[model samples]
Target: MMGTIQNRDKFLNQIASRFNRPRISSPIGKPNWKSQPQYEVYKGATQDELLEILKEQCKKIHTNFVTTDLKDLPVVVNDVVIDFGGGPIVTWKDERFSQWGLDSLMKQEWPEQNIDVFEWDYTVGNENIHKAEHANVGITISEITLAESGTVVLLSDQDKGRTVSFLPATSIMLIPKSTIVPRMTQAAVKLREIHQRTGHVASCINFITGPSNSADIELNLVVGVHGPVKVTYIVINDL
Candidate 1:
């Protein structure tokens, strides 16, 4: 849940009293930096250009990248599921799936194909995690796409469980072209804007770069040791 300090002033006042200084409750203005290089990378690049950068980064990260329009998203997603050894799939309970014409694909069509589909339900609690653990694939949509690092940001909420992206053997992230940004700098600014406007942001903001990789064991690079073994990103061009 989105939350704020219940007794912020009281808590700070107690700390100030111990320090022997008066509490300064007013907000401080941000200092101007001498150099703001964060905005310089891929500056002024169009969405298409950003997509190209993301594609290149995907190769380096060992992530499969595919581009499609809204018209073919369902087909592309279905194909990816099949390619990854068709589910038993788990996905967040996000409305966009229905909004983008994927409701039937998840709810009806996949089941018809004898593919078990599980949507995270907060009311069901731990059952969600169990389903994700056993699912062949987990699918989710990106809230923010980093073109430079080929990362996708996921904001956790009641309906969007983190396990949907973490537990499954294969993971699929749906990216809308419009959500693609140059890098982390742009993504951070967007997040700040959201917090400034709403006074709160998601409790957990995940910056997932491809799938989980680790070299902790004898310096040999291993993939999917801690997360999904295979990762595929489907970028919707006309979303």
Candidate 2:
């Protein structure tokens, strides 16, 4: 078993003695900055402006961006799945799928169209990983989106597997317009709020920017070296 640090305060006190200062055990608050430039970008901008910024950034990142209302989300998702070469598809077993009216698409429509869909089930253990590894496409919802970078943030939980984003050849990320933020600074602030309120946070948080691309191999840019070759961001406007 892992051991706990029983002498944490003692150790710190000793270090403080060496430095000729008293040990500070209190939790330190965030420093007040002279100029909070981080909030300057897209400041006072509406959600629509942020969405526009995200769209422009998507073009540079080579991510396919689509905008649709909640009413048409299922249809848009279906078209994306078919465009990405219909299943075997993998997705998180999230209630939001049903909340967003995607129950029919995942449960009935896909199967009826002869496409294999797999939802990440924690009870089955590694079987989820096996299925994700072979899936043609994986779908997930972005918990928070960074407009400046076109980044989708995913927080992993029991039903949400991280592999669903990286293991597949193609990934489809559902973005609710309400989740869009100006930049990472806003995203970090939101995460801190969650931890402060709940005293807990997701074990893993993934910030995916388009598909994987690397230039490590002889300096030649290669896509899909470490993750999906294609990435699509479906933004739900009416959500």
Candidate 3:
């Protein structure tokens, strides 16, 4: 045991040498994220301007975007689902979707197109979860949107399943305009504060920028190699 300890310490010292540091240094400043200047440019922006920046940034990353009013949400969602070629769809089980009329709209549109739509159920979710992965379209709610990076944050928990985004061929995130943040740093700060207050985080907090891509095979570019090839953000402007 004494010899093992010496070897471990020697290995760590060698690794630190590459960085030209003998030991780790204590972090500086208050734990408060306000001390960090990473997102000040965005956190200080006007709401309207932030929305515009989000749209522009999303386009740059090849994410399709659409703005709709509260009443028009169902219509827009239906359009996106249809455009993705009408296949099996996986969606949320939350009743809040009914409040938005998304549930009824999907029922009406999917059946007419001869497509099957499944809602995520936590109690019996494990056995059938794999089926959701090959769904033609996946619709889920987003907690936050980072405008500068065109990223949408999906905070998954018991009620919200992770497969809603990872398993689908096309992923559609439903977000409200109010959830949009100016930058990723601002989002990170908010998340840290939430964890400090609650003492726990959900199962996952997904930061999705765009569709999955890779250039590993033959040095050729490929999209959707690991996940969805097409991603759409449906921002409810009046939310």
Candidate 4:
């Protein structure tokens, strides 16, 4: 056993030395996302104008996509099952909760509402979380963002859990427009900050844009095989 351990250590050090590993350079300066075709820049002389512009731009992405302040989210989402088992864990006393009023929103509100609450952990979720897949829409908060690709990032960590984003047919992300940056490089920097502050690296990090789509069937496009078929992002902003 001792000999095996020594050999393993030697081999590891040899591999590490051969590669001349160096610390990754910190991201600096502006991001390259401005060059992407999908990126849209919406700004106004006033913050209120920016909010309206962003709403219109976001609505154009899909018919089902709706941009409303969290306060405007209907008390009841009709005909949809929502699961909050492994979503974000914000302060119980925060104003953020007032917008969605999630704790107050009840499954009983919908005649056909199905709601399941699950534990937030690293393993596969319980039956309640899995049952969330039957619902047409799923909502969750983002852990980070990749500005260049217009991608929302989720890490399998404590506050922002993973399962909530992957299981539903339609995923709705409530992102604050202020968090938006210019590129993926800036995103990496933000992630590093999270790691440094939290001292925990996420097991899985997902970068999702739009819906779960594929074009693998002899030149035909398909969607929603492994994840949500439709992805709608509601860019929430304060004007």
Best by lDDT: 2
Q: For residues 1-239, what per-residue lDDT tens digits would candidate 1 score against the true structure?
A: 99776988788899999999998878999999999999999999999899999999999999999999888889999999999999999999988999889998998899999999998999998999999999999998898999999999998989999988989999999998999999999999989987899897897899999988998889998887866989999999863
Q: Ten residues in a row with the worst lDDT in model 4?
A: 84-93
Clashing pairs in 2: none
Query: What C-alpha lDDT do the candidate models reach, one value each?
Result: 0.92, 0.93, 0.82, 0.53
Per-residue error (Å), model 2, residue 147: 0.3
Q: Tens digit of lDDT per residue, candidate 3, span 158-181? A: 767888888888999988888888
Per-residue lDDT value at 86 in model 2: 95
* TM-score for candidate 2: 0.92
- What is the C-alpha lDDT profile of model 4 across 147-214, one tens digit per residue? 43557776654534565677755676766666565546657878899889989788888777767667
Residue 189's C-alpha lDDT in candidate 2?
A: 97
Off by over 4 Å in 3: 1-35, 196-200, 217-221
**Residue 239 C-alpha lDDT in model 2:** 41
Q: Model 2, residue 154: displacement in angstroms?
A: 0.4
RMSD of each: 3.3, 2.0, 5.3, 7.7
- Candidate 2 scores a C-alpha RMSD against the true structure in Å of 2.0
TM-score for each predicted model, relative to the true structure: 0.88, 0.92, 0.80, 0.60
Model 3 RMSD to the real structure? 5.3
Model with the higher TM-score, candidate 1 or 2: 2
Tell me the tens digit of each residue's lDDT in model 2 across 1-239: 99877988888889999999998878999998899889898899999999999999999888999999998999999999999989999999999899999999999999998999999999999999999999999999998999999999999989999999999889999999999999999999989988899898997999999999988879987877766999999999864
